[model samples]
Target chain A: MSVAQATRPPKAPAGLTHAELNALRADFPMMSAQTNGRPLVYLDSAVTAQKPQVMIDAATRFYEREYASVHRGVYSLSQHATDLFEQARAKVADALGAGKDETIFVRGTTEAINLVAQSYGRSVLKAGDEILLTQMEHHSNIVPWQLVAEQTGARVIAAPITDDGEIDLDSFERLLTGRTRIVAFTHVSNVLGTVNPVRQMTRMAHRRGAVVLVDGAQAIQHLNVDVKELECDFYAVSAHKHFGPAGIGALYARRSILDAMPPYHGGGAMIRSVDFGGSTYLDGPARFEAGTPHIAGAIGWAASIDYLETLDRQRIAAHEADLLGYARDRLSEVENLRVLGNPSERVGAVSFFMSNAHPHDVGTVLDQRGIAVRAGHHCCQPLMKRFGLPATVRASVALYNMRDEIDALIDGLHEVNEVFG
Target chain B: MSDLRELYQEVILDHNRRPRNFGELEPPCSEADGHNPLCGDQIRVYVRIVDGKIEKVMFQGSGCAISKASASMMTDALTGKSVQDAAKLFEGFQAMVTSDMDATVGDEMGKLAVFAGVREFPARIKCASLAWHTLQAALKGAHEMVSTE
Candidate 1:
């Protein structure tokens, strides 16, 4: 561990245990599934986490029993719909340690990022302004700024990631200036799995008079994120990356900043009134959420929050830490296969390139044995270019993944070596 | 080894290790780059045609086991074959990848028979046909094309 990691807060919060994690997995029906007759060992949680039965049931029940357009109709059912929608918002806000007014619902992390880019970026950013981002960001975080920069003639600057996969805070400090509008990067890298020091980075950005936006798609489910504690001005997350249903995410902005930004998409729900002269937009969050939001998905997302509550999430984090450590130890034993970004504080993500065998062959071979792992660039093409590889095989874990699965993965790695031999 | 056998065959790994018919050809002929950015597979097929007959066919670039193997197989299959004949071969091989029946592709694909098994793995269709597609584009006389990204 580096000096920075040694001083950084421990990976997980206090007070979590094993009985808790097992119960958490029991809540998810997918945990009990079999793919090709073998238990479905899903290790692609960085892409999307498995949905729990409770969240699924919550979504289905909403459609089956309480189906109505919210905030529109004056009927009893519509009122019920509106109440459920707002309650879900409140639940998510509580989960993220944010206020309801600060959270704006969108489709997923991608849309959440586009929301910030179009609203805050387009409206506030002027020519010669700079948007600072880390090289470890997913394309979602990197591209939106590019789009805004292209449109506004603003320059997008990159903060370098050190060889160990952590962001070079010195490089970040150098990139900062009065003209740096936004510093948007991932809270935890999806490919590298390095948990960034969000609090420290946010404070740094704040001192430089810049708003920081964190792509929490990878971190929201894994960490106990307190946006208030981090003092992050804008935080983006996708529900699917957590244990919730797909197509639901939230962009949490400090109330003042969200109020300052313009509406992203022009639509019916977002407008207070429309006349020939111009349309008056609704206040703050409603201004950001233009179309009909993910109503059922939001309700299900709330159920996911409820399900996460059952397991002390801190314990789940610790259990994953142990599994991650065990996996790292086992995988490192494999000859000629070097794990990418073996950070002192890595989340449950392992990206590695075989010395002789290409990653596609490795992924295919793994798939043949009923073990599924993501192959290729993992959507970080720039990161691929940084590492000077076309792609890599990635295995990411979640709360439900067990020690035996790690054994299976180790066996699979050896299987790859044997095949190549 | 037998079950882990089909997908990562010795021939596939061999091509991945020492890709046949590799390296770029100078311009003045047709060329198309096939890229699968998802898997990070890249291939460039360069063609030399004389009187509508492909007198010389060579390919260059790096990719995964399936792609490199498929490229070597295609180059070996089409070296003496004409542009028209190569197009037909490309069509037949594409059916093997896109079509649901594995036997149809396996039986028809002569030297490209190794890729027939890739038909079973649908996600790898891009990998199997990356070289074949570049060949088709080259035959159609498209130039400086980059794909797969």
Candidate 2:
């Protein structure tokens, strides 16, 4: 089979059957594990995904046999390691429809955004300039801009979201005034599961002469992200959220934008030559990746991408959509339970509140039943404040998740009501 | 189920449902806000001290059952008690909740013994202790909010 044929599964039906899903779940060892003596019903994939055995093996193999410092040693082992690392980079870049030289690996999404804020943001923003963001952004997207705004005297402004948790496009356009130098927002909200119209937002920001940065942390895992198609100047994502190892992610920026920006950090690998005077820096992604990178994490992340490529992403999306619909339908039946948002389109996650119980209390009850869900602000305190909620219970799904798990979650919710009733 | 029942005993659920001394105290009272950044649980504790004794203690905030009940029960126990006794009780309460599951609850804890199950849920120790920590800050006349980061 050709490499493309090997990577891409043949087109199948729109969604996977129950048996096929169960077979896929076997690839993730955690699916069989128990929590608190009961079978674990993991519904917290939005926070971080459970890794498949292939990803784990890839990382373990790299550490155990192929470990070496890349772009440093002349030996065959180092060359082989360099080949694997670069191949991983190429895979990640290809997944996003970006060039290999345009992808720079960092610690995670938070660091990726910070890289742009400190490097690209500081270079352009000035006093009285504004940074436009939506109210549904995670703290990772919001705080980085605020930090840059504080340093550069640029004011940070937030566009409002509708009662249904979708961004108000009219307000977003209105906020993109001449003073707006950069528009940073999330492609998919981590809290509300609202998928923003990235292409539309990018066109609006561009028409206003503002550069756009998208937090793709939540989108990359659930959606088929094409940074080029989105026309976002910069895109950031985390590997851990993609069923890969933690502590590694990528920032996709066009070559021209990257070339114009100064290096985020100065260190050994990033420098071409050094002296007591100023040192010259390497060009492309190397300019930002200081020191040795997370070699094992990169390989593991590539393996995860490969694992995802083997399955039909469209089918996975359909399955998740079905799960979301089922969850919402069952949640509405619970007495006094309120689903937080009603966006026209949502994916992977659903958040809710029970009038009789605090989210934390509800989380505890669910835990006792071996159901795992996130109960907190979900790093979107501003969004929570807009809804007048201190916190909410968030249950997110992944491709490996099944409809029965949603049933288990609904049962857990009923238990929460009974316990706290 | 047993563990959940233990953590959310009838007394705790009742206290959470209708917290005692649930409103802010008027003037001559010192107040401190306690925030649990982890879960966004916020609590404000107020105390009016006169003649080295707590003349009145009240609290107002929003949090989980563990935290609200803790605050409610704390106010009930500290009312009319000497400031020194209140401090001692705070230390004991902290110890009881943080101790191992097998540790014995001290006789001095009295009704506060209901919280012994907190030790089993380490993630919840902060939830049960937020109000107490805020009370400590209020007693110390701290102007800044206390955070269980």
Candidate 3:
């Protein structure tokens, strides 16, 4: 079949029946939302996934029925709340094939990376040490390392990506020297959707005695990520990137590595004993988690994981891959529009720019049509600089997204072209 | 071709396609950079004022069609006006773009009334005003970058 004919109306592979996917879509109330006079076509899941009704209900139930602070009170409500909160940590660990003690609940991937850099990085890295990173890392992954490197007198070196945006494996391996103390990179690029071979890269880094931290913020939502299988020393994921509440995420680190790191934040709950001389700290996970955590957010995150457990992940991934291919094919047909990367394996996100229209203009026009997209640097200014672009318009897919939404996005781009022309 | 068309008027598109006074001025120019971090719109405004009148105005940066067009139209409107007059016009243009739809757009604003449609898009007001803010900074002889947060 001709390219246009094949891509114009893309079809999902026969995974879950149409009714099943529709029922799943029905779980998100925002699916029926509108802007101006058009139905909402949410193509910005990379920014934040729309929470499902289960997540809302879970958080509401915690507040309405099981409302209390965790880990401190002798009261029954507090005890119950504590159990559920800790259970949430277990759910995050289970999702990543990690032990409960290996996971520390934090506030999103940004905070998670900061915790690692400040605690683990400061403890291990010394003067003249090197922290190697990939070119496609989000600002969250890059900035934290830079801060830690500055403090420890270490330097951050970036391994380059190929022209099509895949991690240059040879360059990455070469960059892993004796002085390389840490190797941090994104599991999947937020802007390009390029899925790095985390297993292979982690092994390579480990061979050179460098600790690897995979920023799995963009990976866990769309792909089945197992930190154990990847064999990375640390992995960070945000619950909000999936169908969970905001302000909560998880960091998975090896038990040995966590045991060696110091406490990142000094506050209540992270200490075991207080004395005038000094304070004794708690164990690994507890050592990192200070202050009262987001209790409701954790419960809601567990609920999201529970909801994900009901779906066939392989089937969902297949459907997402099909959507990505179809989107690339269809988007190519738009005149003067350039889809940013042609990675061998891309996931949910696609960044593109129309030659005649700036990303902000395109984003504004799309918003008017009730099609939401992320525009600008997407918290990846370094990557934008690598591509010689100031910004791009990004449309990211989720499990609930349908081919109709892609059609709507294509229609919105046509409108943008008309307006700009 | 409704509210959107109003926002992206032919005049605005024309200015975007061929922005006027879009280059750097040599030394002896008062210049300031403006940034709207939300959309990554960056603009540098350069002015050569003589006897308090804007003898020449130019802008060099990359941004959206609205931002580039707004910068282009702003330079054209303020080139021959005094610094105080330019500030007044900037205030009027800002009010016209951000205020109520029925807010007055006096003939003093001239071609800048096209940005009145920005009132409908609250997020784009910064895009339409970056160059103007930079212009204000230039007039004040401020060296720090101006940001429309």
Candidate 4:
């Protein structure tokens, strides 16, 4: 065996058994489903992870039993709803290693980033200022900064990634000059699965007097995120990427910073006082959250966190690492197929190209066999261009994915090769 | 499986491998670029219109098999046809691809019928029609890029 293979962790460790981990699949109803008369093998968790039954049940129960507006109504039901809503916020904050007051609820990572860009970015950035970002950021991370920069007469600069799909730290530090106001980068690349050195990068930016924002949409599900440990000024995440409900995510900001930033939207829940002349906004998270939020979605997301906490996170991470290693070895054996990057530290996703077929065609062939993978630029068109590829087929592994699924994906690629030949 | 096979038939694959009129036309009378941001599929449709007829129609770009084949077949179907006839053919092609399986294929569709099975994959409809949309934009003298969104 290769040294890489020799060092691979065992399937089951001392505490959590492999059987126990496999049993967690039962919580997800879609695990046993069949698509197009074949057993479904989902490998598109990077797009969105499937929710557990507990999360689904929590959302349904909220709608069926505890349906009421929060923070306004005073009746018993309304009070209960308000309590649950706040509890959900607390749950998310706890999972992210943040304080409840520092957490602001938004639609998803996109909205969270937008809120920062529009409110904090507009407040701080001036003419000739720069917003530094990495090349591997999702469009959500890039476009919001572009819009804010355009409005503020600031320019958005990108830090280049290494050939192995990692941020060049020396280059990043050099770019963090006196004029860079904000630096936003992904904690884990959605396409290449490179787990960035967030803490080190944040320290580097802090030394240069630049505040950092970490896009943790892909990392929150796969890794334990502690904002205090990373020392990042802001962290954005999406619930759907973490086996939680869609339309709900949270932003983790330092309490002082969040308190100082202006409101992102204007509405009933976020105001301290309203008048004919003008209005004043509330403090903490309420300042950013403007409207009646996704109450059920927040509750469902908290329930997902609760479910995730039940598992040994270390074991889950190890299992995913093993799966990624196995997938990398297996896929590399395919003829004329090339995995996009070989980052020293990567998570459970792999993006690859086949010489004989376009990514869409490969995706279709895989889909026909009930194997779901994402194709196209995977919303990293700039990175795609950097890699000199129009598109790539991405197979992302979730906790529920197994070696057999990877085998199925490899078989499907063989079929793609034969058909496109 | 049959629907998948029908969507990517041998003829379609052949056109993808060797697309007709695949390069840029020098100093064309009119041209328009097309882009599908979702897949990064890009095509530039160049046309030479004489009188009220399409004297020449060609495209240059890189895309998936369906998109490349659609562009090639469209070049064959539109050349030597009147401008109004090309518009009608665009409508027919659009209807054929976006319509349900039960929708009848028009006899006038001819070679364009190869894309009728695109209805099975709704996401690919944009891929199959990107060049046609660019062609329409070119004929309209609208130099602005066309998008499938």
Model 3 ranges off by over 4 Å: A1-13
Per-residue lDDT for A340-391 in model 1, tens only?
A: 8766678869788888778888887777666788988888988888888888
- Can you write out model 4's per-residue Cα lDDT over A162-232, one digit (the tens) per residue? 99998898899999999999999998899999888888888889998998999999988787788887789
Worst 10 residues of 4 chain A by lDDT: A1-10
TM-score of chain A of each: 0.95, 0.97, 0.96, 0.96
Model 2 off-target regions past 4 Å? A1-13
Q: Which of 1 and 4 is the better model by DockQ? A: 4
lDDT tens string, model 2, A1-421?
A: 2111222234334688988999999999999999999999999999999999999999999999999989999999999999999999999999888999999999999999999999999999999999999999999999999999999999999999999999999999999999999999998899889888888888999999999999999988788778887888999999999999999999998788999999999898998899998799999999999999999999999999999999978688777888888888988889879999898778778999999999999999999889999999999999999999999999999998988989998888888878878
What is the lDDT of every predicted structure here?
A: 0.82, 0.92, 0.89, 0.90
Q: Across residues A1-421, which tens digit of lDDT does each residue of candidate 3 receive?
A: 2211221124335555688879988989988888778888999999999988999999999999899999999999999999999998999999887999999999999999999999999988899999999899999999999999999999999999987988899999999999999999998899999888888888889999999999989988887777777888999999999789889999999999999898999999999999999999999799988899999999999999999998877678767877777888889878879989888778889999889999998988888888899999999988998999999999999988888889989988988777777
Q: Model 2 interface RMSD, in angstroms?
A: 0.6
DockQ of each: 0.73, 0.94, 0.82, 0.78
If the candidates were sorted by their TM-score against the true structure, best first, what order would they fall in?
Answer: 2, 3, 4, 1
Candidate 3, Cα interface RMSD: 1.1
TM-score of 3: 0.97
The C-alpha interface RMSD of every prediction is 1.7, 0.6, 1.1, 0.9
Instruction: Locate the minimum summed-lDDT window of 10 residues in model 4 chain B.
Output: B21-30
Q: B1-149 in candidate 2: lDDT tens per residue?
A: 89998999999999999999999799899999999999999998999999999999999989999999999999999999999999999999999999989989989999999999998888899999999999999999996999998
TM-score of each candidate structure, all chains considered together = 0.95, 0.97, 0.97, 0.96
